[model samples]
Target chain A: MKLSREEVVHIAALARMSMSEAEIEKAREQLANILENFAVLKEVDTTNVSPTTQSIKLQSVMRNDIPGESLPAEKILANAPDREGDLFKLRPVLE
Target chain B: MTDKYTDLTIHSAHELLKAKKISSVELTKHYLDRIKKVEPQVRAIVTVTEDSALQQAKQADEAIANGKATPLTGIPVLIKDVMCTKDIKTTCSSKMLENFVPPYNATAVEKLNNAGAVMVGKANMDEFAMGSSTENSAFFTTHNPWDLSRVPGGSSGGSAAGVAASEAIYALGSDTGGSIRQPAGFCNVTGLKPTYGRVSRYGLVAFASSLDQIGPLTKDALDSALVMNVISGYDSRDSTSAPEAVPDYTKGLTKNLKGMKIGIPKEYFVEGMQAEVETAIKDAIRKLEELGAKVEWGVSLPHTRHALAVYYIIAPSEASANLARYDGSKYGFSYKDTDSMWEGMEKTKQLGFGPEVKRRIMLGTYALSSGYYDAYYLKAQKVRTLIRREFDQAFEKYDALVTPTSPTVPFKIGEKADNPLQMYLSDICTLPINIAGIPAISIPAGFAKDLPIGMQIIGKPFAEKTIFKISYAYQQVTDWHKKTAKL
Candidate 1:
């Protein structure tokens, strides 16, 4: 279950993480070992079994649509690393 | 350590306050002074909120004078840094959100606040709640109070260690896996993980959405119960918060193990576990029988062996999705060196997250990727169903189950840091309870060579009282819970 270096690179890309060659190699070996453990799950017969997404019963939580007090804009924006007036400032995605 | 206020439990401290022997400010000063002295050795706290804690202690004293005191009134406590504390730094012991201060309080914190519980500071945790040991913490490793060279099990290591070291009466910690219970085991304290949806997850930072729940790390079973009474209730803020009535957790906890059907799951006593841990847990189970519990052996949970694999899939898959919010956009750390926003997001994550966090994200992304989804993620989820069904079926026949909280005593700090799979296996005994969404308590059973051993009592869903009662019964008969680790 050795993941190719290319597979590791592809995953890092998908996760928006950049890893050096050494890091990718290490991740490849480790992830493969963890996944190897999952080989046991493949043997279980789950033909009609439904996947459990939530551990408890599901329900729709309702709330009134009426406007209520909320955190002020300044407070909501307090933790932003970079901000402009009332909006977040970000690096350019397209120039 | 010889001071009167240093090792006070919440119940005893409350009585002293009620009798006017000590004001909340005096008690707090003693604890604050204690923290100043011991924190250099234990390193369990991340941010010490001295000014605000004393302010809250002052208010607590005023409330006590008016005879409007609750059980937690004037009690000093610690909140795990994973929970949001308005205006206080809520770092998950990671650089990613090292300075992230939320504008709100976690529902559990709010409950403690209403009860006049004084929050002294934020406790440390594994970065993003990712590691089994506190070595993964970015700031510093929290030393086991019993043996400073060994790790206090994590990611709730700091909270458990704080209580064991007599730094605080108790602390609030979040458990997605074995985070709460394992650390409590390592530190010789009582830790409870309530049934899923029992406590609100509104302001706690999400790791694995389905698995995360907040609970108390305290001195003994009774203190854990008292804290549970305050924090366990419905909240409209979290959609998953249960509407179930929270019973008076401190009441009806008699040594009535008579005819209380208990199952000792055979799968839990896996091969290669520390022999000392096995002997201690078995001795605790026998003591339960002596007190009249109808203990049964060889109960099978065949799916138990696969629990760790199922958890790794479900947890990290959910984590990869939950953590997508940190993209150098709305809050926390941002990378400014890159002009390309996409590259900036990548660099931000790379620089901000620790190794374990990135490893989990990669494991999750690889599992959910197009070709592997059905084979890994979907299959794991289905097996999760099988595991839950086993627990539910077993509970139908037994009132509760008993197992070792952790497979071994606390290991040396650097023992398993580099090996991810080995670290993950440390939680094998405790993960299935989270997977099945049941309640479990880890109470100090005995010690192995001076390090503490913990016995886990697990109950059916929303049956926290039953588990707490059993743990309380055990505490009544044994002095293990009464012993404190020497700092």
Candidate 2:
């Protein structure tokens, strides 16, 4: 339950967030406290109890494979931070 | 600007509209003028669609003239910023999505639009619906109307506060734990968190997909039921939406509770619960009994204590995944001064998200990380099943369960802000119902030292009718729901 400073950094990296040294230290303490609170769950014996991912048990809610109208390319790209002629532009991933 | 229409409920407004006593344009203008007057102190609204609302109101008036008006026609409603409304900024009170305007309306919003409801504004909420108080809103904190120094409980704080302050007749809020009900309790309004899948979540910004639900906050239970009639239905876009037929929720508002077995779960009366809250809830229970409800105390939900822990783990884990889409890519806040996409994403999230949001993301990241997933995430889900089973067993014997919606009355704005654990505990009495995915409502029970206290009535899955019936029957005899804040 005790989250070390290094562990906090790792988690933040995985979460794609950067933090100041003070925030990291604070997060370390706060996250550790929250995790400690969660430790109480270990006492509950849930053997053979299936996890309930969703409350409603619905079978595949499939729609017919018919073509439907789509948002225009301009509207689709309207909110993109960087776009070029209706296509979203991202920084080079392979470079 | 007439001050008279500001205090009228959705029901009263509908009657007036039908009788031609007031036009929708006149009613909408009255609320808009009131919003202009009270919004400065309450800070309940994040965006006020004045021009569009008036236009919608004019159309509603035209519809009324043509005899095409529905129940919600011409009524003004505040929407929680989490539910998308086409072209209106759905901020979720997070700077990450502060400028993001959704191109599509959420199914709930679309339904309201179809029913001719006027969009008053988007109500403020905790950043990404992460906090129990509006203090976590990146833009500004919403003050409680009852006591300006106190917080309207959140993340649906603005919706509840808006209704309490008469800024709107009713509002829509998404409850991912105690968001709607807790705020309603704090503001002395009625809010319902429908059973999961009862309402479509198609364009609602997800916090924890499994736990989140869209519901109504109104002046009273009857208004909540009417709004539910418009918003609750199946949608093909939402895979989790139940295929069950939608019912007329307003039909369940009959003030008849004779022979209804109501359970009083003993575990909900915890150590830290405020004495005033306990007394108010006990008094409400007595009133229910007098109204012909058979009250049974000491119904045990032994797994209730683990609900908060389970919620923190599961909800944060889901939120972490859901929020990952907020990187500087398609919409929302973006950091451009970076060498690579990864750095830009990191900077965007770090700068955009608030402290509580960051804390949750980190906690969720850690919990769902490779080595820890089995120990934390899976275990929490298993415990969730146990919690749901407890509710099922209780509902098998009792028609509904009653408890205090929150452990305490509305705290001072900064009282528990420093301690996240303490703030999280504000939701202790309400979280278990969400864990079970059952419909529950917080109705004004009474006032404790001028601040309002809420009594929650919980029902089995997809049993909104039963909960609505109990709440309406209780409201029939109580004057608490009728009392308006002086502000």
Candidate number of the best DockQ: 2
In candidate 1, stretches whose alpha carbon ends up further than 4 angstroms from where it belongs are none
lDDT of 1 by residue, B126-165 (tens): 9988887888899999999899999999999999999998
Q: Model 2 off-target regions past 4 Å?
A: none
TM-score of chain B of 1: 0.99
**Fraction of the reference Cα-Cα interface contacts (below 8 Å) that each candidate reproduces:** 0.82, 0.84
Leading candidate by lDDT: 2
Docking class of 2: high
Give the alpha carbon lDDT tens digit for every residue of B1-487 in model 2: 2357656888999999999999999898989999999999999999999999999999999999999999999999999999998888889998888888788899999999999999999999999998998999999999999999999999999999999999999999989999999999999999999999999999999999999999999988888889988898888889999878888888846667898999999999999899999999999999999988999999998999999999999999999999999888888889999778788999999999999999889888889999999999999999999999989989889999999999899999999999999999999988988888889999999998899999999998888889989999988888999888887
Candidate 1 backbone collisions, by pair: none
